[model samples]
Target chain A: MNYKTVLTVCPYCGCGCGMYLPVLDGQLGQPIPDKTHPLSEGRLCIKGWAASEHVVSPDRLTQPLVRTGDDLKQATWDEALDLVASRLMTLRDRHGPDSLAFLCSAKCTNEENYLLQKFARTTVGTNNVDHCARL
Target chain B: MNLPQEVLTEETRQIVSRLLRDNQVVGVIGLRTEHNHTGPHLFTSADDLKELTLEPRYPLATICQAILSSLSQGKLGVIVRGCDERALIEMAKLTNIEMERLVLIGLSCSEELARQCRCRRPYPSHIDVGEIVEGVSPLEDTQVRRLLEQNVEERLAFWQQEFARCIKCYGCRNICPVCICTECVLKEECWVERGQIPPELQFHLIRAYHIADKCVGCGACVAACPMEIPMTTFYTLVQEKLRELFDYEPGLDTKQKSPITTTLEETPLREL
Candidate 1:
């Protein structure tokens, strides 16, 4: 008896097609193309139809995990970030900054990616940074 | 293709019963014999077993979605053809149906039915009951390419004439295996423009462009279309173009993501 469509932009690519995530009974239904959007104008490829999936996907990682003794155990944010920083510093010290490479993710927010690149270049002092979307 | 009166083999029946008993699935959605015409139906209770039929008409997708939506979180079994399998995959991508909870009982269409549907692969790679056979080659429809070869003006005129018959029943969108949007743009007043003849050139163009890579070439749109519009040709062209550009095929591998979504590094086809 309850249904609503929440408008949002697709995150799959830089195309940024506008879409509506239909929520019925508090469950996500499907992505509805935004007829009025300028970029796509009510058109979506297969990815747009599936844009709402990652929001509530079962496969989505809810928390960060750190590998320990051949197994991954969930760790608090502070613990995980500290561990990452220490290991990265140790690698940078021994193997030099160029030894570490940064791989950009499509899943990260634009701001987050910018911050990551900034951290990699200014903090880590390495130009060995590449994007997953070079294609 | 002539549909059988009743086509469920004993093994299929047993599997269906076992799934219903074993899994928390509420029912099995498949064809049913009603008034001598097979149509899609949902069989939840065991007593409704006699009503299950897998012949003539195939409406498993519609029936399964309806049943799944009506019920709370639970499982359901569905009879799937190549088209149904593709529809289910696309639906799962859109979150319209949960693929994990749902059980698939694949059924290969008869060679004649496969031919009639212009099916590329009439059988599922994995099957539970039906015998596997190579799919009939899709009949060639050169009309779209022929239109493409025309000048823009001629192409416009041709499509104008073709789309003129569209009553805007949204049948093509409704029957499309990949068109899962609850609110379609074709129905919107601004995009398609309500109560217009020869619906603006953008109508068909936009819809075709939208489903270009996603279309599985099911021909359901053409079949549901009362106007007999050659939608398959457009989708086939789109499919071919997608393969050429991205080297991706829909529904063949459920594990692999669509090339469009994957990054260049992750996409094997992009290396080419």
Candidate 2:
């Protein structure tokens, strides 16, 4: 019988609403907006209310896959990364760095996105870096 | 769309009986079928078990208030949905119902019904007897979003055209679980003015503001509105914005308090 609430900040946006993750048997119960928190004042939007749904979602991806003969086949981490690097390098050589673009994710930490942008600029030689959050 | 009437399982019946047998709730409030038409009704000790129908259609919150007001002393148990829970939670905040005395038996809505309601969370978090399932997050309304993208004048004009269909039946207020005041501000001659068609945009604005923190997104207001104004979409947007700004979801937890009741200093913006 696991029962505990971990106070964590909502990562959807910069608002950083305070909420509690109710842990039950290693599975997370729905988020309860922290009433004592400074920002939310005990009200959550649809995203905040349903924040926990994604964590346990069966559709959530767990492994890397590459398109192989119309079907995506699971690939080892090194193979996947090597394929990506080789493709990116080929594209940059063929179409120039200005033609290549990179998209970041809200799911990743800010430092991760910063590193991705740095890799795009210094390694890939492209300035066209952006984030899905911009949408 | 008509609700699924035949889906009531035997487990639900037993649960209802067990609840009534155990607690002295004023009554179990839910929809019932009588004279071949279904509507909200209260189930009492004397009422036949056969009369308890969970399907067809019902304004559950309205029936709940009636039960609460008529018999103020006894604790009441309600079979609530996500929206009903939100309304009840907001009502609890306003002191409309005694929280300690009340017991809530939540019933989760199905995915198909949830999608129709554009509900982000279709089920209540704390349920006495029901299987928990994942709910779908609804897509934002295109019409409302398009209207919002327009300038102030266009938006005002659009609302003016929509509100013009109002018959002033007060069905929206009468059916709302959150609009619990005996004397409503919208009815006052000073605030809303008498003999006004559409009740002015300000009237709607005031109504929206009054329930800003409390609107449970039950769509009861929309369902009750004979005029069929897209009130749910508006309320949903406002509710979403509130959650975005504050990160609060209503009715899931009884111990939690709304941000509106507290001073801003106590609940500062997270980014700030």
TM-score, every prediction? 0.59, 0.60
Question: Candidate 2 on A1-135: residue-level lDDT in tens?
Answer: 223346677767656766666554477755645544556543354466567878899998788999988999999989999999899899899999998999988867889999999999999898999988888
- Please write out the lDDT profile of model 2 over residues B80-179, one tens digit for every residue: 7777777777777777766666667777776567777778877776765445556645435677578667898997788788888876656566556787
Candidate 1 per-residue C-alpha lDDT over B1-272 given as tens digits, one digit per residue, 9 for 90 to 100: 42353554555667778878876566676655444433445555566567566654343465466556766766777778777888777667667777776788888777777766666778765687667666754434356557657897986677678888776656567556677676778767889786676677788887886677678777767755557777786676667666777888786755657777777778655444
Clash pairs for candidate 2: A38-B267, A38-B268, A40-B246, A41-B259, A43-B248, A44-B243, A44-B248, A44-B249, A45-B243
Evaluated on the second chain alone, the candidates' TM-scores are 0.84, 0.86
Looking at model 1 chain A, report the run of 10 residues with the lowest lDDT sum.
A1-10
lDDT of 2 at B27: 62
What CAPRI grade goes to candidate 1?
incorrect
lDDT of 1 by residue, A1-135 (tens): 233346677888777776656565587855645545666655565556667778789999999999999999999999999999999999999999999999887757889889888989999999988887785
